[model samples]
Target: MSPLLRSPLAGSGPDLCYPLLLNTSCRLSLGPRFSASLLYILTFSLALLTVLLNLLLIVSISHFRQLHTPTNMVLLSLAGSDLLIGLVVMPLGAQYYISSCWFLGPWLCSAFYMLSYVLTSASVASILLISLDRYLAVCQPLRYASEVTMGRVQLAVGLCWSCAVVYNGGLLGVNMRGPPRRTSCQGECVVVVDGSSDWLDFLVTFLAPISTVVALYLQVFAAALSQARKMRSSWAAAAVGAAAAARRSELKAARRLGVVVVVFLLCYFPSLGFMGEDVSVNSAASFWSTFLLHLNSCLNPLLYALFYPWFRWTIRLIVTLQILKPNSSRATVLH
Candidate 1:
């Protein structure tokens, strides 16, 4: 029996999850049942929305020949990671949030934590790749086409996912051994990485990538401003307007993607705060931080729909099943 299971008032108030195994089973969550149910419903709905939106992005990018650019490939990779988070991580998180127990056993718990870490790290890596892509497109226009090939982008995305898996394995390898090492009680599934490991993971997965994004975006903005000024002053009156329009479009895309990166950083930074110490996954603060991180998946596609007219257009086609039509992949999305 664990200390949590040995509470003096444990069985006196509510029913144990497993009445027969009183000493080992978790106590039912203490709260108004209706409120808990409502929360669960909302969480599950958000998870579903996240999945659907990211799925739309995945399909739109993957199916459209026009969207087969390196930049779109990065977005595709991002949508894939977000899809996994929504489909797998969020549902499992909801179960823990609602039931407040680990009924699924130790191996499943280890696998859940491992998957969560991999997807999250992959998301961060994908954002970094997006920022780099935009930086080159906006700041290094002359070399962008030559440097950022589809093959290179695909290789980078593959490496990002592979590194995520390898990095998390190194960080959480001990915890993945079995229940005896990770869980203090039978009914609880807790992942406890040491403070050192937590800090290292934070630095590698969160801090370093975020810093790179910020730096890259700053350079991008500066270059865009300079380019706008040059276009205004240097080009002939007839050509200036058209050239400026094209440049402005590129700048706008960078700005929109910048918003996505900023939102990602905002949602992700809170989790870093909780990772400083040996944090329990079941803590209230941990739960909220994790919720915010998962909420990023929901917000990402919404950001695309809001900023990218093409996303809205493609979404309409997708929802209406127009994408199933012949040669729909050849449909022009961007004008």
Candidate 2:
């Protein structure tokens, strides 16, 4: 929920965002003071958990030589965005919800929203790449490695981040150009967008990438089902040693990552469902939708821990500091 005040509860606060601003200030907006405190603690705890989990994922992927493949490269990229969401967005979001106030004030508020948009776009891009990689690996195993090389994956990640930055910068250009309108209550960083911009963002950031990801994963799922019934299916490509083994591995990864993609779509669809509607930020739908989106930032690492044996093993090694020993980067993670 936005740190914005509803008219009914406008009179309930001795605790205000900016007490010094008096009449103009937004109030710290929850029903009971104790509930607000509990909520803050809960939200912050989740954010911290998100940071730690994603950090582990980042360290595991970055520090391990054996983990450095096109698939892991894309994973590493996704983890980076997730880490930032935990580090930056989640805390800010928590404050926005608990206190219902933009404590950072005017310009930082715009930057904060812009950062969120960039991360959101970048995350969708990362998922799209992952889905594409899985599609190729499952649907066309013979061409997977050649098409999704490390160099190409890295280039794609760079391009995705760069484009996200540019796209969101332009998307929130009105706020980027100047402070939020003064008519807003103090401590409120309300960003009002025209219907045109709303539709544009919905299409670009939500519809297009999400649709592509779903479509690709559909193919991946189909190929997986076919391969499941027949190990010697055309999609799995019978070959000796590494080639065949690699195909099997790729097929497994596709299934695991499919879970990740499904969760992404589920979290996103609600949050972006009413893009054109000027919904009250304080509404239950608004609150739950925003909560779910932030919750998604933490879900991926949890999914990795649950699905990937390599990830669980690496976490143990890293936690035990076994990774500090000589030639540790060469240690086997994938079982």
What C-alpha RMSD separates each model from the true structure?
A: 3.9, 3.1
lDDT of 1 by residue, 1-335 (tens): 00011111122346666678867777766356686677688889999999999999999998889989998999999999899989988887777765666678878877888888898889999999999999988877778879899999999999999999988887789544555364544666666676677777778987788889899999999988787677666545356777567667778889999999999989877776665565553366666777888999999999999999999999999999999999999999987
All models: lDDT?
0.79, 0.79
Please give the lDDT score for candidate 2: 0.79
- lDDT per residue as tens, model 2, 32-137: 7687777778778988998999999999999999999998999999999989988998788667755657878788877777788888889989999999988888
Give the lDDT of residue 318 in candidate 2. Answer: 95
**Per-model TM values vs. the true structure:** 0.91, 0.90
Candidate 1 accuracy as lDDT? 0.79
